[model samples]
Target chain A: MNDQTLFSIFFSAMVVNNFTLALFLGLCPFMGVSARVETALRMGLANIFVLTLTSLAAWFLNTYVLENAPYLRIISFIIVVASLVQIVEMVVKKIAPVLFRQLGIFLPLMTTNCAIFGLAIFQTNRGYDFMQGIVFAIGAGLGLTLALVLMASIRETSELSDIPAIAKGTGLTLIIAGSLSLAFMGFAGLL
Target chain B: MRTTTPAEDFVRGIWKENPVLIQMLGLCPALAVTNTLKNALAMSAATFFVLTCSSVLISSVKSLIPKEVRISSYILVIATFVTLADMLLQAYAPVQHKELGAFIALIVVNCMILGRQEAFSSRNTVYRSLLDAIGVGIGFTIALVMMGGFREILGIGTLFDIPLFGPNFEPWVVMVLPAGGFLMLGFIILGLGVFEQRKKSREAAAA
Candidate 1:
């Protein structure tokens, strides 16, 4: 792929084809941690960190491991990612309690987020090099953050709206998400 | 023991604490695979097999598992069954194997299976855990199938690849897309809310 095309891949992945909104990756955290705006933002940042680091590590591992040892790639990749999440959790808890508290349990939730794993697999599938993989992860993580923050903002305002009793809480949220997804469809060809 | 039965354990999973509709766990699979009845049924069966096997194995050795490493143990156990399900699907139903992709691999992290182990199985007897597994598995399947049926009928004017609507009828393509899954879930949750409220009021009047 041309170097210029790499930048476009990164751009489209982040804004035009957001992982959470456009591709529906990482719906769990998008829905779960979005109950509060502050938590959403913190989770978004934490996700950026973990996702970028893991994508870089995963890219390097993919190149060396899969090229030479295809059989053990999946299992080894998962173990590496899991351990990396654990290490980040410990580091954040010790170094930044404020950030940790805001993220709370969600820090660990990153291990099973699926978006991270999917990113790794997607990068492998697309055959991105190390630099391209990092850019893609940054874009995807930003996309996830954007979706979470927007959903939280909407939910925050929705708390006071005159929602029918039967459609309060999750029902309403899902509807809003559906509409937002519809809106995001407008960006399908921005690339 | 005052009649603590395994049947009761199993039955509770079907209704009382369903991993999907009630507990609201495993929403990814619930939303992702419920586009068609066939996919839903396949997903449900795969989940049931994995859940049952994981429960049996986890419960049998719950006491033996040290508290510090329980999560890792559960992951290993769940991963084993996920591998089995993945291989079976690949060998027998290659089409579905392609359709499901990484989501099948994602069964290792669905949370429902692990949540059940952490909540009920770890402390219960193997027979009781088996029953609970079946109940929850069936309950999860019901939700997926219902969602899938609605989407297939409305979104594609078909059910399990059979055309139900006349040729003149135009399908709402949105219903077949990912957005459709969210919309269907929203309406289903709303309907359930209305049903629950009505039931509560009726019970109150009777009382």
Candidate 2:
């Protein structure tokens, strides 16, 4: 397989094919945790951390463990992701309680974020080697962070504006996300 | 938990507690695969199979799973069914399977399945869990089909690939794209909100 340059992979994942805006991988938290810019940034950092770890774990599993037993990919990936998040949560709680408090339930909830699983699966399917997979995860995590920060900042301002009764809450957030997705589509030519 | 009738358990998930429209659970597949009616139907069918089977299995085996590891156990059960569904689709409907891609496997992480297990099946009777799963599954299918129908008709001027408009009909290309999925669901949720408000006001006026 011809490997894509790390820069291209990073740039593509960050903007051209952003995980949240383009791929629809992690909309739950993209919507749920994006209400405030500060929280969103913290969540993004957590995502980046877990995603990088996931890349390492998934690569190890794919190259070493799952080569012969491909059917076990889904199950093993889920277990690995869940436990990894748990370990991260515990570590964060131990080392940085302030950040842990800010992350709160969202940290643990990352287990089902789908973006993590999507990243692992995509890396495997694309046959990304160790370095490529790690770069891709970092790029995706940054992409997600960018989307979250943008949405959260806009939402912070929108709170003062008069949204229609019908378009408040989730409806408004989703419409905004749709617009963001449209804007991101402009970057499709970058690759 | 308050006691409820079987009918209530089944009906609530369809409307009052709709996993997609009301609760906003499991949105990735709802938005990702609804670009076409066929893909949406296949995804929903696969979800229904996995959800129903896992809910039944989990409820039946709830006691054996210790509280500390119940979440893991539930995931294991759900992942098993998802794998089965994935393989079944691969063997039988390879085309649809390819269209669905990793989404079929991603079903293992779908919050709806895990939520139902933790919230309902783990506590409720097997019969009630079955009803709840069926109701939620049907609700999800309804939502996906509605979205798929809307997107397919506008994006491609067809429903299930049957041309609805004349050959001259122009398609709104965005309706089939990722942006369109978000916009469509946003509008749908908005419409539902308006409907709910009117119903509430009407009831207040009557009272």
Off by over 4 Å in 1: A1-4, A66-74, B1-4
Listed models, DockQ each: 0.55, 0.83
What tens-digit string does per-residue lDDT give for candidate 1 at A1-191? 33547779888888777777655678778878898898898888888888898888888887666777654544555666688889999999899898887777667777677788778767776778888888899888888888899999999998888877778778888899888888877777777
Q: Candidate 1: deviation at residue A56, Å?
A: 2.3
- Tens-digit lDDT track of model 2 for B1-207: 758998998998887899999999999999999999999999999999999999999999998999999999999999899999999999999999999998999898889999999999998889999999999999999999999999999999999889999999999999999999999999999999999999999999999
All candidates: TM-score of chain A:
0.93, 0.97
- Model 2's CAPRI class is high
How far out, in Å, is residue A12 in model 2? 1.5
The lDDT of each candidate is 0.82, 0.93
Give the alpha carbon lDDT tens digit for every residue of A19-120 in model 2: 988889988889888988999998999999999999999999999999999999999999999999999999999998988987777788788899999999
At residue A32, what lDDT does model 1 achieve? 84
- Scored by TM-score, the top model is 2
Cα error, candidate 1, residue B147 (Å): 1.5
DockQ leader:
2
What TM-score would chain B of candidate 2 score versus the native chain B? 0.98
Assess every candidate by TM-score: 0.93, 0.98
